[model samples]
Target: MYVVKSPLPDADLKTVADALQGALVDLVDLALVAKQVHWNVVGPRFRSVHLQLDEVVASARTHSDTVAERASALGVSPDGRAATVAASSGISSVPAGWVKDSDAVGALADALGTVITRMRQRIASTAEPDPVSQDIFIAVTADLEKHHWMFQAENA
Candidate 1:
């Protein structure tokens, strides 16, 4: 933990920061998966899916930054290195070979849905201890849900 003073106690800051760090890891993993799909998607919808995935990647990256920054504001060290993300993130690894458009969409939708579920849990956990942290989780969840819908729509 850093030396910055905050209204929240050290314990609460540590708790919230831990949750935020987990979320950050997942977001970073999600961005990498989205980009993997973007680069490998094939089939008739290839171009559209490829392009749309960039939006997901961008969202994940932005959310990761926000979460990491929040953790820092609370005097926690934000660990966003690739090794940390790989070790901490819950998202499944995307396959190495080229992926079909449908497969990529399905995989991404599932991953997004999983992250949204975890985000909601994080939001609930933060509510009483830190409503501001809850708000951050809420905002991230909403954005992820929107992207979830978009990605799932690709499979329909």
Candidate 2:
């Protein structure tokens, strides 16, 4: 059983909150990309991409929850509030107009790169709280990178 730790250093609390918020915000962007790809995907690979999009979104949501809970465990509030996520997220927003199916993958790749960069920054700065958060970020990065590569290959 996992025992929750209390009285975390205030500095580490802030660091962990920032890290969690960043990850969760990126996760929301991941969800958005998946939805965009699902809705806009066309051509021979349509069904495959569509299915994968939904699957990826589901995974993103799960990771978001895990990050949020981890923040709570560390005596920090989840920083995934909508306004904070929107204002602080590093992921580039999708344009307002319609997106081409082929181009959607590239857009998602950009967002993935943005998220990875932010997580890597956090990994560099965070000194404590819990190692699990960093591990989660790393795992998410791996999955997101793989997704980006698959989409990039398809784009070619």
Most accurate candidate by lDDT: 1
Best by TM-score: 1
* Clash totals, every prediction: 0, 0
lDDT of 1 by residue, 1-156 (tens): 337666798788777987899899999999998998898889888998888899999999999999988887887778999999888888888889899889989999999998998898899888888998899999999999998999888778
lDDT, each prediction? 0.89, 0.73
TM-score of 2: 0.83
RMSD of 2: 3.4
Candidate 2, residues 34-146, lDDT tens digits: the string is: 68667877766567767867877887888888878877777666666677767877777776555566666677767767777777776666635657777777777777778
Worst 10 residues of 2 by lDDT: 1-10
Looking at model 2, residue 143 earns an lDDT score of: 77
Q: Score every model by TM-score.
A: 0.95, 0.83
